[model samples]
Target: MTSAEVTRRRAMGAGLGALAGALAGCSGASGPVLRLRLATGPEGGPYNAFGQALAQAVAASGHRIEIVPVSTAASVNNLRKLDDGSVELALAMADAAEDAVLGREPFPRPTPVTALARVYVNYTHLVVAADGPVRSVKDLAGRPVAAGAAGSGVQVVTERVLRAAGLSGAPEPAPVPAADERPLGLAASVSALREGSVDALFWSGGVPTPALAALAREMPLRFLPLDDYVGPLRERYAPVYTAVTLPAGVYGLTEPVGTIGVGNYLMARADVPQDAVRDLLRVVFDRWRDLLREVTAGARLEPRFAISTGEVPLHPGAVAHYRSVYG
Candidate 1:
């Protein structure tokens, strides 16, 4: 048999098995066992893809998973959902986790949550339209912009960033945020820019985002430099926020953009069985490469960059696995 045929068969089997597992979980047919739900973002973004990959890997380990798709604006909402027994697992930015637990910014109320693992970096890029007058963030004053969806963790930090830069409107300079009707998921937001609906945008995501690839098709879009912002982010949000660069070819971008970023963590309700968390961590790092294939965020998933929890405690189960491999 040819290599292509073998690859196709493997994919088919995996897809079939995933379907069976999802059905079994929904039907309560996977025998009598504890169940967990994951609140992931959007329908087509990398966050949703990452959630599916995680479900697949866990399903392969004889566990059932029910994925709850939510808005990217709702990552912070995941915390409330987890706390209130609506869902069990979800992705969150590290800074968001810190502030949420401490009752800062968007949270406005304390949320007692912890970490399962440091999953991916949330690189903040001040993206602008190719033909727009805004070359840097300074030039953006009265432009029509999409800050982010309401209840979005990105919106929380983005508001602060705008204050730091003295810009307003959507990124904070505008008197009011753009209506949520546009629903700027990474791909949609970039498309809006290309079409001239939005003059500037801020995206907090992992490197080499597929959405950025679409925007890169525009020959002259620029990433606003934020060397100054990085220092404040580290100081205000915790040292986990680090300097980052969206490299040239990562998105076919003309030049690297200096920016600040934070981590996107895979977290769960504290009530999740330790055994499940342990097994999930084992399957994840073991098949890390396969997971990467399922989502572009995995392209930058690295153990070295995955350990800065600051005060956010790691799940005991995950710490056991991380120490075994890294030590």
Candidate 2:
């Protein structure tokens, strides 16, 4: 192995040892194993895939902690589950986490959710049939569109994007009846687009999402440019959205497409045990490459990026872990 590979392996081994020691000290020689429920996105989505990989990696490290991945609507739903104490951990979009922590529209009151890390970036995808009538965001003014699952981060961003394009009204906390809007998950959205029930669909996820990739194979697909609305979205909300490009050759694209980007955060309830949180972060950082391979290829994770969760305060354990690393 190369020098870099050797260093990485050594770091992972040390992290595993720290985690094992921490867990052993917490639970005596024969204490019960600690199980944590992690709320992930819908099946077949990046969040779910990442959660599963992280869980497996943690288990393989020989730690006495079990991470149970729970499927749910992405982002918004995940934060709600974390807030209500239904799940100890959750993956959510940074925007959604900010909303939850600040008592924004979707959340009735400020939620006591803390961040574990800013895990990755999610690209907003506005997909339409190659030869469809909706060629741009404004073209969806009267066309039927799948606006993402009802309680998903995709839906929250979709509403804002639509509003920025002057194609929709103010976002409501609950889904409102509209002739052109359909609140469907990734799977259902793909089926609807194929069946001609929806003219377009919006999804925010890692590039080359499996469902979309499969759909690309069945027929031609076009990704409408969303970079133009980043400014408007930032003006209306916090500066949580960034302009990003979907590289060429992904999902059969001939050229890069510009879109809005948002960070994905791993969050936890405010009351979770500090040692548990620290142990989890150890595995996440040490095995981040495995997570990227399982979720999004070409994605990146590092101490700087992981600690950049805006507005969402890091958990005490996370802060401790980072301090130790920096020291």
Candidate 3:
């Protein structure tokens, strides 16, 4: 976890400390002094920016926070980090969260982490070699692709989509050693796709992802519908998924492509001090628009969409805040 800490700490005003401390299980989690740690994804990715915004929002609320901005393998690592107490907050995909909470055999032991809210939907975009024989997703049958980093949420869903699309990821168990996989990094995956080193790619992220955006600028690219598999995927996975469309020209692409995606959520260990969590959510909803303006393409954030996080259960604290703000 490569984390950039947000050292700008502040004191949560007045008597809120004792209240927040009690909820966090702290003896004195008191006196305008609480340093909450947050784990964010890679620098350019949405989570990092979102996490930073959260940290700043909390800080602005006069609470102390130690935001550990990290470049994650993505979802899988995020969940592990949270469950193990490596991080207090993490951005999670709905599918990954489901796998964790259910003890879904192949995934890590099910850990009942609480969800703060489903911030937004992560659109699964498949990019293939523009000049290669692969056009639609089906064309890449029996080929290699970057699912996502091992242990990252990307790999989890990548394999799911492949199976959903009637394909499979490398069957060689532990294809790359876990430790080896750790440093393999996203650049390797992106590079593999660029050189035709792989057949195609399936990434679940917010629209105009840096990788997709970069590839679109460097070479020809297309977003595969894979929507054809959505209905079946939904029937099986159900609530974790929903249809999200990448509007035409979003990536400056000529046509719109519909794909199946899951929501991106902020999750916390159940004991994150309800008062702190309570204050955090209050600030986010109140100044969301201003926060969005800070991230390059974070315009997708809107108050109306903020409460749409039904995919992941809202943090009881967040729900309290939401009810007060929008309910």
TM-score of each: 0.79, 0.88, 0.79
Q: Write the per-residue lDDT of candidate 1 for residues 1-327, one digit (tens) a residue.
A: 332343243233322221222223244454534455677776666677777776777667665443444544446766667555566677877777776666666666555455777766667877776666887656665566666665566666666676666664344443533222233556667767877887877777667666776667755677778767878767656776788777766666677878887777787655455666777777777767666664544355567656666656666666776787787
Q: Give the Cα error of residue 134 in candidate 2, in Å.
A: 0.9
What's the distance in Å from true for residue 91, model 2?
0.5
Error of 3 at 117 (Å): 1.2
TM-score of 3: 0.79
Stretches of candidate 2 above 4 Å error? Answer: 1-30, 170-179
Per residue, candidate 2 scores C-alpha lDDT tens digits across 1-327 of 332343243233322221222222256565656678899988888999998998999899766788989999888988888766678889999889888877788999767777889988999999999988888887787689999998999999998887766667753343433337789999999999998999999999988788999999999989999999999888878778999999999998999999999999998876667788888988988899999886766988888999998777787789998998875
Worst 10 residues of 3 by lDDT: 1-10
For candidate 2, what is the lDDT? 0.83
Worst 10 residues of 2 by lDDT: 14-23
Per-residue accuracy of model 3 over 1-327 as CA lDDT, tens digit each: 000110011111112321243223244554445555566667666677777777666666755444445567667788887666666778888788777665563554446466776667778777776677777755666566666766666666666666555555443332321111112235666787787777677677777777678778887766678777778777776567777778887777788888877877777766566766777666766766655553334455555666565434455677677677667
Best by TM-score: 2
- Which residue pairs of candidate 3 clash? 3-69, 11-62, 12-62, 23-273, 24-273, 75-153, 76-152, 76-153
136 Cα displacement, candidate 3 (Å): 2.4
